[model samples]
Every structure is written in structure tokens, then in C-alpha cells.
Target: MAWYHTYFKGLPQRAWKLNQDEEYTDYEVDFLRDVLEITPDSKVLDVLAGYGRHAVPLATDGTALTCIDISQEYCEELQTTAGRGQLPIEVVCADVLNYALPAGQFDAAYCFGNSFSFFPRTEMQQFISQIASALKPGAHAAIHTENLAESILPNFQARNWMPVQDDIIYLAENEYRAEGGYIEAEQTFISGSEKVTHHVRQHIYTLGELTYMFEQAGLLVVGTFSNLEADPFQLGDEQLYLVARKQ
Candidate 1:
């Protein structure tokens, strides 16, 4: 099993929830609405949708949503949340690679939360192609990632630690494996009397390479932003939010 399968269960999940606030989610949802030109009648697909942070808010306004995630915990939570509100959200607990996406069924799609870096070259290509196939012509798709070669190479850190809460400290030891085009990280979360650790890997790609991949997948790269505010993506930007249109 991949490290991410078990990485988000304990301390990391808590930290993720802590970092992404409701305000931030609203801002991102607004960006998605603008970029994808979403309407209340639109059908959207959320790949690797963790706990429905974006899906819930988008669905609340009447947009139909189909969210796929590997974590059963997250899927169940999202299902319960949607059920309670009677929202139009279909939660699928399955890996993206194995799941079959219906062709031309969606008006838009997005993979948020930096989950684009989860796959290496081949798998990444397959996923991108699948997303392209899933969207109608002229429909849009967004991908967010902080693992771009230009983004991380300039601000590479060997070790870093941050306090998630009053008691929990999250530390990361990262090694950039140039040969593999990925970063191997040993992350640990230390809370009072307990410590949880995970070994994770994130694949990195250059912007030009990603553009070519999108082209090959029958998608056109329309724009790249540094943030949800629609700022142009610079070389050393810490984050990347890309918008593509299916051809």
C-alpha cells in the first residue's frame, strides 16, 4: 500500500483540517466557479476529494457533485454530512486508478489539495487522460500542486517542523531524489505521549512537461495561477493552481 493510504488517519488529518479553514475553502470554491464557469445545474467531479471540503460547499448551492476518494473514513464522513443536509453529493470510496469514469458525463472536474503529486509519470498520464475523457468538450478542469520542480527546487528544505496545536508538533525530513523525479519524505507527528510517522513520496514535474501531458491527453492548458485569487503563477511560487479545458 502507498504511504498516503495510512498517512492521513491520525495527526496528519488533524493538521490538514487545521490548515485549511472554511474561509480558504470558500475562496477556492469561488475560484473554481469562475474558472470552470459552474452553474447550479452543472455536474462536477471531485477527484481525491478529501472529506468534501470543497464538494460540500459547492453542492450546497445546488450543483451536483460526484466525489471519489481512497479514504473510507473521509467518504463516510462526507456521506453523512451530505445525508444530513440532503445535498446532491455521491461519495465513492475507491482508488481513482481502478474506478471507471463515465465519458463526457461532467461539465467540470478538479483535483484539489495538492493531490496531483500523488502519482508518478505513467499513472499521472493515465489519470489526466481519464479526467479529460470524463469531461464534455469545452468543459474545464483544475489541478492544484505544490510539488512543481520550479516551486520546490528553489525552496528546498532538508528538515522542517511546525506546531499543529498546543501539543502536537509535525516534522518532515525530505530528500529530493533527482533520479526518480520525486521527494522521499519521512514525516512524524509528535503529540504529548504519542508519536506517529509515515514515509511518503511525491512526484514532481516541470510546467512545460505538464503542458505537454495535458496536450497529449486532449486537454488544453488555459491558465496557471499562483493562488485562488487568479494571480499569475511565477517560477518560484509556493503553489500552483492550473486550469485546463477539454478539447
Candidate 2:
């Protein structure tokens, strides 16, 4: 199994619960609805859907949703929930980088929760291209992730810990290699007597770099925000929420 599979496998139960907080999910759904201009007749794609935090709500709003994730457990859970709710959601378990998507099939698509930087630069470009290919011409694509600018900031922390839930804490140690434009992180989740660790390397891209990649993928940038709330992006922002349209 892939390293990420093991990493994410240990996270689903607690991570899903924390991420599926009602307020956060509602904000995300509203953000996507506005940015993607979603409607009841829209066909949407949620890559790296996890436990369907965004998918369920989007489907419940009457949009047709296709959710793809690497975790079979997450996919199964999402499938069961969609079935129980009789929502228009289709769940698929597959690696987003290589997953096959029907060309021009979607009206909008998104990858949230910092899932954009999972691969190296070349592979990341391919991932963007694949997303563009999956959407109809003029369809919007929204991507949310940590801003690379944060890594270059002087106040960047090499190690940090934060409470994720009642008894769970998340600890992260980061190493940024400027020359390679990548950040390697070791993350630990501590819950009572149990602890789990995972290592991940993410290619960090400047706004200009990301814009070039999106252009190469036939996705033209339309807007860039600091977050899902439509705040203007400025220097020192920690998160980037970019919107583009397939050409």
C-alpha cells in the first residue's frame, strides 16, 4: 500500500469528525456554490472527497456529485450515507492523480483541504490538467490549499501542536527546502494513549508558478482569494483559494 494510504487510514475516524463540523462544512459548501456558480442541475466533481464533507452537502442541495477518494473506507462510508439519504452522489475510490474522468462531463470541480500540493511540480501540473480535462469548456474549478508564501515568511514555525478534538491533538514538524520548492512534514496525531505519525512531502508553488501551471492546463485564472470567504489575497496570507475556468 502507498504511504499516504497508511497515513490517511489512521486519520479517518477522528479527522473526519473534526473536518465535518457543521459550521465549517456549511461555509465550504456556500463558498463552492458561489465560486462554482452551482445550481440544482449542475454536475460537480469532488476530488479527494475524503468522507464526503463537501459531497454530501452539495448532493443534498440537488447537484449531481461524483466523489473520488483514495480511501475505500471513506468511499464506502460516503456511499452508505448517500444511499441512506437518497442523495445524488456517486462515490469512487481511486488515486486522484491517475483516476479516469469522463471528459467535459462536469460543470464544476474542486479539491479542497490543501490537497493540491500532494505531488511534485510535474505531477501537480498533470493533476491540474486532468481536472481541466474533466470539466466542460468554461466550467469553473476552485482549489484550496496552504499558501506557499507562508513557508517563506519569517514567522513560519518549524514545529507546532494544536488540539483537533476533545482528546485529540495534532503535532506537525516542517522542513522547507527553498531550492527545491518543497516542504517535508512529519505529522503526529495524539489521542490519549494512542499516537500516529505520517510523513508527507509537498511541492510549494508561488502564485505566479501556480498561475503558469493552470494556464498550461488550459485553466485560466479568474480570481484568487485568501480563503473560501472571498477575502482579498495579500502578502503573508496563510491560505490560497484560487478560482479558474476551463478554456
Candidate 3:
């Protein structure tokens, strides 16, 4: 089984949650709304929307959100949260590559939280194609990742540690495999007396490579930004946000 199959269950989930804050999420939501031209009547898809961080807010604003995530723990939490707030969110717990997306059903779609780097080339192409198929013609899609070649290669670190919370620390020991075009990492989350560790891998794709993949998927690469501020993507940027439109 893949590491991600069980990665998000225990301490990783807690660490991930701690890594994000309401202010940052709000900023990202605003950027998504503007970039996707979202409206109350729009139907949106949140690919791998763990815990409904973006879905809940967008749905609360009246955009219907269909969220798909593989983690049952996350799906249940999202379902309960949506139920409590009466948000228009549909949580689907399944691997995204296996899901049969409704053709032309969504006005916009997004894979945020650096989750876009999860798949290798072939599977990633299929993933993008599925999102394209689910989008109406001219509909847009956004993908965010920290594993973009230009963003990561220039600042690659062998090992790093960051505080997730006052008591929790997240450590990563990474190895880059140029032949495989992937980074394998041993990720550990330490909190108080408990420590949880997992091995994970993320594929690295350059801008040109990703653009070509988008083209092959019947989507046109429109813009690439380094941040939510809509700044053009450049080398040394910490993250990448790419927007494409269905052809």
C-alpha cells in the first residue's frame, strides 16, 4: 500500500491542521473566488479537500462544493462540520484517480494544499484529465504545489524541522532522486511524548512539463503565480499556484 493510504490518519493530520491557520485559508479562498470567477450559482470541485478547509468556506458563501478525499477520518469530520453549518458540501471518500467525475458538471475545480504533487506523471495526467472532464468548457482549474521544480530545486534541503504548534514539531529528512523525478522523505511529527513517522514521496514537475500535461488534458495553461497575490511564478518562490482553463 502507498504511504499516503495511511499517512493522514494520526499525528500527520494534527500536524497538517496546525500548519494552516484561518487567516491563510481566508486569503486562499479569496484568491480562488477571484481566479475562478466563482458565484453563488457556480458548482465547484475540491480535489483532495482534506477536512473541507476550503470547501466549507466556499460552500458557506453559497457555491456548491463537491469534495473528494481518501481519508475516512477527514471525510467524516468534513461531513459533520458541513451538517452543523448546513454548508452545501458533498464529501466523497475515495481515491481521486478511481472516482468517476461527472462530465461538465463543475464550473471550477482546485487541488490545493500542495496535494497536486502526490501523483507521478501518468497518474497525474489522468488526474488532471479527470478534472478537465468534470469542468464545463472554459471552466478553470487551480493547482497548488511546493514541489514544482523551480520552486523546490533551488532551495532543496536534506533535512529540516519546523514547529507545528507550541508543543508539536514536524521534521523532514528528504532524498531527491533525479532519475525517478521524485523526492522521498521520512516525515515525523513529534508532540509531547508521542512521535509518529511515515515515509512519503512527491513527484517534481517543471513549469513546462506541467503546462504540456495540462495541454494534453484538454486544458490550457493560463497563469502561474508564486503566491495568492497573483505574482508571476519565478525561481526561488516557495510555492506555485497554476491556473488552467478547459478547452
Candidate 4:
């Protein structure tokens, strides 16, 4: 299947070169910084670190990073970028569901931009375990996902602008099918050359289920919120940000 290639192998160029928001964004950049609570001595692991978007910046800011991705293309891009710089970023190209945990204690770990939902529940459990294995006791873990309730009803829809080119843009309308964590939609991109449609699907989990999964994985759900600001979660919130620590 092209799932790995489409999502990981091809991500770096599309993200950095094409300006995809998941890889390059000030808001998220700031958010992960806050999530890591980065320190000069922090050793961080970013699962599904694509295009080195988070790793490069985090490494620049002085946090030693080990970035794991499913795509060799992204790993190569990250390595090349690191070679062009002074910092050493550990980049691994392996399936997140199957990547072996690095053998070292880490200060913090994270999976941002809703990277976990790419797998079904069976894989999600193992993904959580792999993340926990990377951490020392009491190390913090943060996961950011789109609001869960919104996915339950699939009543949410929005049109947003994405920069497809220097002067061109793509108008994207996103929707979800609320039935049992199934979310599917389309993104139609309009530019001078062609009109392209991108199909998307993700399973959304509610707060209860999210916490339940974390606890099942032997991680304590210390807090849950709707925004990176750590605001209390409320229905209709735009996002679901969860924070935890290994038990």
C-alpha cells in the first residue's frame, strides 16, 4: 500500500517544499516547544517527525532530538538538513507501529498533529507503548488531536485556505463521517495547472476513550484540555490536547 509512502516518504517535500501546515507552522512550532518544555539539556523523541520540521527547530534551540518517521524520504531530508547544520538529529525511517524504541532515557516525548490516528486501535495501543518505552520514569508525553466530539457527530465542516504556490492558493473544505470514529473527506486543490482532489480518513476518539487508552497503556492521564493553552475541555472545542506521564 502507498499509505506509508504517501504519508511519510513523500511528506518532507510536500510539507517544507510545498508548505504543508503540519510540518511548518509557527503556532504548532510554539505549541511543541511548550509541550516539550524544552531545555538546553532536554533529550526529546518525536515520533512521526516529518521533514524535520519539529526536530530541526528543536535541535537548533539546543534540545537533542531523535526523530522517528515512517518514510526514508523524510529521514533522508532530515539527515541532509542536519548535515547542513551543526546539530545532530537522530532520524529513523521505520513504521511508527513497528519502529523499535531507541535504547536511552529521554526527558520528554510527543506525537503532534494527530499522528496517532493514522493507525487503527490495535496499532494505536502499540504506538503508545513505544512512546512510553522511550521515556524515563515521570517523563512527560503530549499528544494533540482534533476535537473528538466533533468526530462523533461528523457535523463539523469548514473551508480553509492553503498556500499551494507563492501566489496561488487551494480552497479546502473538510468534513467528517461521525459514525464510530470513522472520518472521511476530500480536499480539492485549485491551481493554474490542474484541479486536484485529496482523499482523507482518520478515526477520532472521544475524551473518555482517549484517556482509557492511555491508562490502559500504563500511562497516567494527568490532564486533558482543548487547546495548547491547557484550557479545560468543553464540548464544541476545536481541539483535544492530552498530556500524560508513564506510571
Error at 191, model 2, angstroms: 1.3
Lowest lDDT 10-mer window, candidate 1?
3-12
TM-score of every model versus the real structure: 0.98, 0.93, 0.98, 0.81
Scored by CA lDDT, what does every candidate get?
A: 0.92, 0.84, 0.93, 0.71
| Tens digit of per-residue lDDT, candidate 1, span 169-191 | 98999999999999999999888
Tens digit per residue, CA lDDT, model 3, 1-247 = 7677899888889889878989999999999999999999999999999999999989998899999999999999999999999999999999998889999999999999989788889998999999999999999999999889998899899999999878889999999999999999999999989999999998999999999999999999999999988999988899999999998
Q: How do the residues 162-198 of candidate 2 rate in per-residue lDDT, one tens digit apiece?
A: 8876878888899988888877889888888998888
Candidate 3 segments exceeding 4 Å error: none
Instruction: Kindly indicate the candidate among 2 and 4 with the higher lDDT.
Output: 2
Q: Between the candidate structures 1 and 4, which one is better when assessed by lDDT?
A: 1
The model with the greatest lDDT is 3
Tens-place lDDT per residue, model 4, 98-143, is 6678744888888875665676667777778878877887888888
| TM-score of candidate 3 against the unseen true structure | 0.98
Candidate achieving the largest TM-score = 3
Query: How does residue 37 of candidate 1 score in lDDT?
Result: 94
| lDDT of candidate 2 at residue 121, scale 0 to 100 | 84
Candidate 4 lands at a TM-score of 0.81
